[model samples]
Target: MSKIGFYIANLVKRVQNYSRFKNVFLQRLPQRFHGAARLLFYHTFTADEKKLATEIESFRSRIPALTTDKEIYSYTSPHSNTFQTDEAGNALPGEYVGSAAEAHMKTGSSTFNGILLRRIVAGAGVKKILELGTNTGFSGSYFLSVPGTELVTIEGSDALCAIAKQNMDRFSDKHRIMNMLFDEAITQLLAEAETFDCVFIDGQHEQKATLHYTQRVLPMLKPGALIVHDDIYWSEDMHQGWQHMVQDPQFSETVDLFYKGICVVGNGSGTKAHYDIGEYLPRPEIFRKNW
Candidate 1:
């Protein structure tokens, strides 16, 4: 899109977000206190949040040089044109041929999302995290930034997994990298009777797969555990899957941040609610980096 078009679209989104914010928070405050409340809600950031923001900014700045332009083969989803298949047309494990620089640029989460993930982990005090996609380990590093956090990240591509292992090693040694399909890794975890404080679903952006994996992992989540669904708006089907999750009885609360969706399991609130706070949140530094 052209720069003007992008600006216009963003302006429209901001207007809609303002309306939602007003309904969700401002309207509930006393009329005279609304201005003060809004200011406090958006302007204030905890010390941890600031620290995470700085860490991600510094980390992302070094990614390009670290990855360089080295060519590599990463896993390809069946939905992609490059996915491998047998002569009989049966699907087989496939590799996506691309340079490390291209893979990171195309697959890694943005700096804004990285900071958001880290802030959530730190705020929720997440110790054990199960990440479905360990694409180059960029986002996984953020999850591990919080002290004492141990991650079990799964990636289908061996090459990508190896890179992720190296990246995650920089943060902590308390992580396990599984270079296998999502279902396979999840099965192993379930068989081991493993449970997690948080689960990040960042792979298989298809509706059926998303729902299926989420249901399969339900038994492996601890009480009040968080289930984060990335790229919720990637496609109509993905959005539908996210909607289904929001309506599911297991989650006591759901939050839609446009780019990412979050669900809390059995929060014991005796009520279920969904919040759309993507545009409502402060993001003045989202585009600070040139990349």
Candidate 2:
């Protein structure tokens, strides 16, 4: 079966197995769009996905600081997390062998969203950060690392928001917080009449829409600020999105590591620079020696 076909078949099987899949949203979604429904189903799950949900939730629960530690770093711990080194202990490669996990735990991202976020947060000396796509509060949580770095993160799902809220309680008193859908968030942000030094765009993986968000929010960024897009290699569309943004002839650099993409917007003339910050952990040796 095709990818979307498999998803629909599995969904039907799930609905047959459990009443949970027969919800108003699920029924209405497919009825609204027979072809596009699979996109939603692709990310969401049927009854079988409960296993992943359980695993991911369990992993979230184990973390001491759910908001920052687990959400931002891609489940790799800072102290135990190793780095790349040359044959003479200089520098060569890296990997996230420390903690490999999926979004909901079936399969996690190998890229290290955590490390880059920390480095940039500290390096930029940004006093405030606005994060898009605050999934489980992972990336947004990283804002806690910078002393007094205020955070305004947005997430779409109410369930995810509740889970993020629970996780964020650990660091609730530390940073500013805002969890809502992207559309509602744009309205809220505009109404607040506020702007930030940095904005991390990691929302829905759609290429054109993501680019639209980047463009719409450009004026909200600081003159020498930073805006990073995750999973540029996630799809051809995303790759195209990355390419389209850089084509404006306004950027100084663009970087791509297979897992993530970073774009920098700054300088007096508004040039752009993008980079793939290699491997976040650079510990391929662990898998070579162990796994």
Candidate 3:
């Protein structure tokens, strides 16, 4: 689109975002319209999603429960990471999973990756974790909340990285968060000869960028390492990136759970596994819960 068109579109969106009744643009005229307010939204959202707005109200009617640090990691393969976790759910050092973050979804990492992360951590007993794209530091805080864990989160925006660093500091003094964006930081991170138990990519939304980040971090992955990319259905770009990651021959032993796609290195034949983890939230006690 032209710059002027883009500007006008953004203006319209902003106006709609703050408007009383809501007025959304329909790029193409619909074959049928139930009502003025019921027209299909822009390319980003479909008519079926209108139910989500109503579901939020019903969700608020019930109190949310917490998913603890231990409960988070119980989902990982019991044989993969190997830890001495108690029955109550404890992430023993050196056995953990890592996850990515996005700008708009605050505390989403906990709700999404928190349980799986702790389970993988406890299972693998992973002592170190690497994360790309630290926004608001909620995911980083969740990772740090694990028992005896060390983490390194990288972000391109210095301002955002600084905020993440502060949040990480609040949880634990041992983490190392970097301010460089992933594009530039990948080289520096690789140069350090670091090998993490878990490598997470949750930064840019573009397909090519996500692929680039994956390849850039490939050499940094140790044996049995797990890479997580968030928001598979957040956009077409994201879904395309995730599809490429799983279908391409370069990687195998993968899991595509719609909301989050995981790439595994080493072990197993070239078989691919797909699951429906459905979108989930983090344990409320360990991390802030998003309403």
Candidate 4:
């Protein structure tokens, strides 16, 4: 593209972003309340929480660089080139497993969730991590950001496995991407008596699969290990599974962060209460919930 074309493109993008902001935030609030709303949001967090929140935003800002087209093709393994493109010559994103777009579901954990996981690993002394649904290694990258942390991620799609492997190539020694079904990976790990300090479930979103994973990982957790469930309210099925998990006799504590859920495996002695930190609310509680 020429310089004029680039300029025009950036201008168009700026207009789109501004329109989006107006429609999503400004349109709902009266002009007189807009400034007060901003003040209220900023006043909701402490200094330390604000700092952590900034860090999360910083990390999120860099994610697109890692998943850019240049980066994807750079490491995309020799898998089948079956992804389809629209009439506009744009490639469509892949959906989850079993869907026609299974190879394209590159959406990773949200920035909030990534920061939450990082805090869990750092605060919980988590060294060995197990992740289900290593879609293109986006979340895997975040998990491996902690020093000395090793991630064992299970992804069923061969294309996605290869993509994740390539995406996480820098952390060669820190991650192991398995190209197999979640159940198979769990069964094999169970047979090997493998254990993990922290576990993240994000791949399959079905109630039965979520419950099944909970059952399998229960015996594999170290005492007092932390289990994080992604997309707890993604669907009625997921919500049902999360409700059952919070009620399970195994977890001593359970927290509902709206976007994700966390459970602690132990004597089941804690209050077993459910706490909700709204998605729009700053998530300082995520850092403290491990206790």
Candidate 5:
């Protein structure tokens, strides 16, 4: 029965992917109906989107073997309510362990998600972006692909930060990489009175930390700014955190894409709403064989 469901889902995706009329219909639908459109339609990439995707993939291919082969330095990750507990059920600090390639493959956003990020920034005319996790700069590259955009990305591991800097250097000088914990970076930005058009929360996949960091960054977001949360369904705790966020009065609308979630700061609507589109869409593979 599950396999039958999977096949049916794939067939629906294929129809949506190749149907230009359906794409146009989805694009022309009223904003209020966007949730329904997103659930039933697959976005068709524009020429610019394809160009940026190509460039990002090209840059990814040229990554030096040394960089990809190196082992990531172990570092203490932020407290995660889901997995930070010890064998005795006491809470403890969690450490990161993986190779650079492994981290990029597992943690870095995929090309499909990157295209979605690019479309969001382009569609919203986002100028300034704050990214919580810089996993070798794969996703940051996508955000920076939009012309006249500026980014400030934060990463907890010094080793990963260094790698991200190297990768980001090929793209643009408009980005700043901060090798600090998520909270530290957010606090620094807040203290500087800085504001952003979009904030991408990709680090520290914990329920408590997700809510805390999001609340801390609210004051720094410009009016109508976007808040994107990655790995929303990573765990029961993370999903609960997403649910809590969507219910908050601070956001006017929230979209749940299973792998990631997005919240809009204001929509001029007094009521809050949540959209679940993951079930209708297929999850993109984490790694591309061509790259």
Candidate 6:
């Protein structure tokens, strides 16, 4: 059944890819074919990037499957909830157990997203990193894999924080897991006068909070620091937040990878570059930012 599901997923992806090729590239044959140039420029991953992706996959395979520490079937009671689809019809699998050890939970970020995070950390040469969300330490494992880097992650749930701590024990003291609300954690960091070389903002997907963090984290980032916002197209609010970030003067440049939007703080000359990942196409700002 899993093999069949894999085959079906591949078939759907190929169809989607071809549809995008037609709609985005072939539609503008009479005009100045910008889509082809953009595709050629961004779609080709480098050799080193491919190798790193393979390594990330290998590391992910070794990670253990999540299991609850409590007695069986406690979470199967009446109040379990799950997020099946977003407004854009993007669906996610997996049953979300409640916020307890007895809930039989299996949830975290995707492997490809984890690879992207790891790549950003390595590519940007970030020494001090901050993550707004620590979901079961699945992504935390990738962050800890890099040498000479210190990671500080904030999680609102104590149960999830406990699980993340257990998962990140291999890193010992290199990583700090704070079980606190996003605002509270950022307040503490602000009081400490902490600055980060790279920051992954995956918490509070709403528009106001997203903009708030984008602005709030600027003072906490070193010059040329990489700031990444996850789930760019998760909703209207998220898209609006991403748009605000792209247009913000503080982040002089950006690279939009659909699932995640990456921005840099520097006096860079070029404009915001948009690259399509999965089925999402680049927005018109890519050209306007350049022009």
Q: Best candidate per TM-score, number? A: 5
List model 2 lDDT by residue over 18-131, tens digit each: 443334334533132222223222333435334433433454644343333233322221111232333543221222232322343323221134534544566557777888
Number of the top lDDT candidate: 5
What are the per-residue Cα lDDT tens digits for candidate 5 across 1-291? 366786677677656654543455445432643432443354456676677777777655544442644677534434335445446432332466655555454456667778777766766778999998897788888888778899999887777787677777777889999887667677788889999999998876677777877887899886578898987766666777888988888898787666568888975566776665543456433221221
lDDT of predicted model 3: 0.52
Please give each candidate's TM-score. Answer: 0.73, 0.56, 0.55, 0.61, 0.77, 0.64
Candidate that beats the other on TM-score, 1 or 5, i.e. the better one: 5
lDDT for position 216 in model 6: 70
Model 2 stretches astray by more than 4 angstroms: 1-59, 62-111, 176-179, 250-252, 267-291
Q: Tens-digit lDDT track for model 1 on 141-210?
A: 8888778999999887776776677777878999999988787788789999999989998876666667
RMSD of 6: 10.4
Residue 202 in model 6: lDDT = 81
For the record, the alpha-carbon RMSD of candidate 4 to the native fold, in angstroms, is: 14.0
lDDT, residue 33, candidate 4: 28
In angstroms, give how far residue 132 of model 4 lies from its true place.
1.0
lDDT (CA) for every model shown?
0.69, 0.50, 0.52, 0.61, 0.70, 0.61
**Lowest summed lDDT over 10 consecutive residues: which window, candidate 3?**
279-288
State residue 142's C-alpha deviation in candidate 5, in Å: 0.3
Q: How well does candidate 6 match the true structure in TM-score terms?
A: 0.64
- For model 5 the local lDDT of residue 86 reads 43
Q: For residues 1-291, write the lDDT of model 6, one tens digit per residue.
A: 355774566455556666665676445332222332333324444475466445544433333444444432211111112324446432222233454332323445655666567666766677888998786676777677667888899876666676677666655469988877666677789999999988888865655666666777788986578888877766665676688877777775566666578788765454443334434332322211111
Q: Write the per-residue lDDT of candidate 4 for residues 1-291, one digit (tens) a residue.
A: 555775565455545555544455546443422332333233244355456445434433344443434233211211123334457433333343242232244356555555556655665677899998787676776678668889999876665676677656654467888877667787789999999987898855656666767887888896578788987766665677788988887886666655567787866465454444332343222221211
Quantify how close model 1 is to the true structure by its C-alpha RMSD in Å.
6.9
Give me the runs in candidate 6 sitting further than 4 Å from their true place: 1-105, 267-291
TM-score quality measure for candidate 1 = 0.73
